[model samples]
Target: MAETSDQDSKTEEPTEKKVRDALEQGNIPVSREAPIFASMAALMVILTFLIGRGVQQITLTLKGLLDDPDGFPLGAPADALNLLTVVGLEALRFLTPLLVIFAVFGLAAQLLQNAPNLVLQRIMPDLSRISPLNGWKRLFGTQGLVEFAKSMFKLASVSAVVAFVLRSSEAKAFEAMYTDPVALPEMILSIAMRIVSAICIATIVLVAIDLAWARFHWRRELRMTKQEIKDEHKQAEGDPLIKARLRSLARDRSRQRMIASAARATLVIANPTHFAIALRYKREENAAPLVVAKGMDVIALKIREVAEQNRIPVIENKALARALYEAVQVDQVIPAEFFRPVAEIIYFLQSKQAPRPEKVQ
Candidate 1:
């Protein structure tokens, strides 16, 4: 009941990252019936194609030994060993193709459903797997009951299919008792082929249904609660407080750099306490005045202090400082609209540097 309540609370679909992590951990949606179908398919193939020739070869080898046992010195233990080796080799040769077919079919079945992923976690030892409580839960839980129902359905369906196949061949089977031993092999193979073919057909339908259900059930199980989704979001995007702190640190570093660069400016435009824009101008270095640093409040005071220490001129201009601070970026040439006012300031500074032509002598 508690588990069902927990499952019901997962209203949100699993995120891609959650699904990816599950895949990496080897938690994949695999229908158990798919591999059973593959085995049935392999068996059908063996019955249809390989079994006839394989059985023929083995029978011929066995017949050679059995038909003339008197010809061989069976009294000698070495002779018996030689005969055993031949029989074993022939048996192995016959079984090899069957084994290969089963292996290839099984691997293909798994590969078709999920791409191969190597997950060591799956192979790692875990106490939970052996815990009696967990085992009991697995055997009696809702999912366990569903699994039980599926197993029972498969067993009944396959049994019915096998019974029907056997019934259809009942006449042939009864005649096998009276039939010649030589013809018995072909008759038996034919009946076995029909049974396996019917089983394969039956399992193909089950495989389709089970494959879809397995994936759907897997996704349903992975669904996230609202709080889990929010927690995952926070983890991915980062904590709000930490992000704000980072932004604050970035602004502080920027202010420090701005104050440091202000020492290179030729003149500092100030609105007393609120705004300061430091301009660097050189006829040979730039086409127009460059605002190398600008700041407000505490940073504005820092820029002014740096300007004072560097002996750079601090010109008070309430309107121009406010306008330039709004319009200009640090390290960029001031725009055209403010050219006249700023140019007049440059002119005044140049006038101060103009050689007093001469005290009129």
Candidate 2:
């Protein structure tokens, strides 16, 4: 009941990370019947392309041996060993090609269905593998039932195909009784081929269905709940609260830098309490007055304090202060629109500081 509820809750499609992890952990689905079909194909190849030549070669060798068994003096155990060795060599020569074909077919089937990789998780020791309760649960589980059903289906299909093929070839089988002994194997091979071909066709259909179901089942198993998706996103992107804290720290550092730089101002324009802009003028530095710092409220107060401590002039101009605070940034020159008003301020300050002209008398 708990498992079913958990599965029901996992309604969201699996994320890319989940699918990738499943593959790395060897959780991919594969159809078992694909290998059986491959073996049947290998058998078909052996019957069609290999068996005739191989059998003829073996038969010629064997016939020569049996026809002249006593042609040479063979009264020793060594002679018997030699005869056995010859027979063994002939058997291997005939069987090696068949074995190689079967191996290649089986490996190709697996390779076509799945990419090969080494996954230690599959081979790791686990007590659950040995526990009887767990084993029993597995035996009666949904996957176990599915496997059982597939086996029953394959058995029934093969049995029916074989029975039908044999029934249709019944007359041929009886006729083989009067046929030459040499031709009996050929007749049997023909009937066997029909049976095998029918079985292969049946299994091909089953394999197709199994492959589709396997992929669907695997993807379903990988689904996540809404909460799980959120958790994964948090893990990748970090918590919102923590990120906000980091941004706040960055802003604080920037404000401190701006306040510390206020001591370099030539003059501070202020709105008495809310706005402040620190300007620096030098003919060699820039064409227009540069805004060294600007801020509002508390930061504006701090800039004013720093300017006063450095003995920099602080003039009250509400409109200019507010306009500079809105339009200018630190280390940037004021815009051309404010050149006339600011140039007048600079001329007034210069006239105030000019030395009195000395009298000639």
Candidate 3:
């Protein structure tokens, strides 16, 4: 049983149908590293654009508080609350742009990883998700190990990048420290930006590796078993027995309609057994003769019955009947190339008494 189970799960590549079904179910592979990379990159951009203004604003606020200590409320609780509110508002204003930037990057990262698709199933709850076995599998299985390894690698890589940046700039940073105090803030900001740039570059490399792994892993997970492929094929093509029955029913209805249409035909040209084509012509209504009905074998026999019952002429001309049956469809004019032959037959029928019905071959 165990071997059988393994065999059933042996498929290593997903079919296109499986991938489409998985997408409909909102089961897509996601890389945790993608969001981390986007956030870090956004931070690098934000810092590059706003760090100098942010630092200068905060420094001014601090200096104002220090220089005017008496301006701050001291004892009264209401006054202290007012003072706190002002400071809180200032901090909120400073952080709001960063928060917005983070949110935009997060959204962009998710959309990049999985292009926009409406998946109603994703919002629906599944009891299977709460099962203890599934939870345990997620916590302790290969996925858990992979996640842990990724986290450790990211942490180590970022730490290594920061250390390298700091080490390389140690001389410049030390020199800045000994320079004018008035220039210290700008110098510090420059060093911080350099470190952020290095970290962003490193995170980008991790994101690329994770994206490739995620796609490969997703494809493997969506693979179908041999039985699943068979089932999907059956679903797409329909059950052969059921399809055959439907086709038989359709043919029966079509044959019945052909017989009814023969009621208005001028004559039926038949091959004596296998082929029958009913022709109609009206000089006032149409310029050419129309093939109103056609059939083969058993249907040809029925067409003969209908033609005789309606007093429609039945001419047995094997070659003409076969050609008309092969080339012309019900309600269609016989092609111009065969018009002369059909016209001659019609002229003969008009000039003579309608022939008695003959047995169909």
- Give the alpha carbon lDDT tens digit for every residue of 174-257 in model 2: 898888999987888788788888888999999999999889989999999999999999888998899999999999999899
How far residue 341's Cα lies from its native spot in candidate 1, in Å, is 2.2
Candidate with maximal lDDT: 1
TM-score of each: 0.91, 0.90, 0.74
- Residue 2, model 3: lDDT of 81
* Per-residue lDDT of candidate 3, residues 282-354 (tens digit): 9997899988889999889888889889888888888888888889988889999889988887777666655
**Which lDDT tens digits does candidate 1 get at residues 156-207?**
9889988998898889889989889899888888888888888888888888
Best-first order by TM-score? 1, 2, 3
Q: Report every candidate's CA lDDT.
A: 0.89, 0.88, 0.83
Give the residue spans of candidate 3 off by over 4 A: 1-17, 46-49, 117-120, 162-195, 263-297, 307-361
Off by over 4 Å in 2: 70-84, 353-361
lDDT of 3 at 318: 84
